[model samples]
Target: MTSIEHITLEVADPTAARTFYSTAFGLDAQVRLRASEAPTTGFRGFTLSLTVSQPSTVDSLVATALAAGATTLKPASKSLWGYGGSVQAPDGTIWKIATSAKKDTGPATRAIDEIVLLLGVADVTASKRFYVDRGLAVGKSFGSKYVEFAAESSPVKLALYKRRALAKDAGVPADGTGSHRIALGCDAPSFTDPDGFAWEAASLTPSA
Candidate 1:
């Protein structure tokens, strides 16, 4: 199975982008590269390098956005966090584009280090049992339906919730259908719960 490796975001500048992310999410920048010096292909650290489009194309896109009354918070700059930058849209949305740090390659020694994903399900108790029966250990349960599953050594937590309720809390439409699939790793087994939520189980390895 293929585990979720990383998440990437696109932004206007890299330097200013790193600052915004560092301040907002406490995310550390791992690498920085200029538009001219960025690789044309392949992955850099954990994040895949971005493709630099032409200046005229970028300018036109920016101008069009500005014409629509978009405000620019930080113009753009190269910083410690690799490519892309940060911008605040007129609607107050803050965006950042930068290389995500590679997962630490150190030994697994922490009690908890990361949260993989939260799943929305129709029934919580049923879902928890489904996972528990499949070899996952159920942690503290919040009431009857809300629960968290602790994956051994990965610092990843599997969260189960009511679908419509979760969607409402997230300010999104409660139209999501079917179970979401989460890939684990090679040699580890994968299982889908009652509500159709899928998870892959495997031993942890040092990330780079």
Candidate 2:
């Protein structure tokens, strides 16, 4: 099965980004950073998500991220689907930490059950076809609005959303240009998706 073995986020300050990610969410091997001067503005067209076990864990992770210099895009709150919030990291990457369980099952452990990368695409149906041709099996989908690819043994799960809706979900404007400043480390041969997000061989990723 296809898997996203790693993810590389290009930032202006790789050193600071490394420290921030490690300190804020304790991410290292799953997410990597490399130096880049790519010109990008407004929304970068994607968001990283951390799915935890319960509401308290979501609150704890959001609080920790804020203390580590993340800016609040949305305060942690209870929603119809669950409790969650969005925060932008120091490197301008938006992260949403959330959980489906409205109540706590145990003490907050800061454990992340899954890491998801949601790409904001122009056409969900078209982009879905692109991945399907490259061996990604659709796990769940909601018409043209959303689509999730099966992750299997991968460390990171992949999903697609309309550009505008995704931006709103991240609490940002739905306009952006230049590079996505992110790359996926995958098991398949290196290729660029229809939306321009680059996917490369997992072996190219640096050690965390």
lDDT of 2 by residue, 150-172 (tens): 88888999999999999999999
- CA RMSD of all predictions: 15.2, 1.0
Model 1, CA-based lDDT: 0.40
Model 1, position 68, has a per-residue lDDT of 48
Clashing pairs in 1: 13-84, 13-85, 14-84, 14-85, 15-79, 31-82, 32-82
Residue lDDT tens for model 1, 1-208? 2233222233335455455444333344222211222222211111111212332322333344355444443343343543333333332233322323223233322121243355667778887777666666766788765787664553334567676655543334456332121223323465545654333343442211
Best by lDDT: 2
What is the Å distance of residue 110 in model 2 from its true position?
0.5
Q: What lDDT would each prediction earn against the true structure?
A: 0.40, 0.92
The reply for model 2, stretches above 4 Å from the true place, is none
On TM-score, the candidate that comes out on top is 2
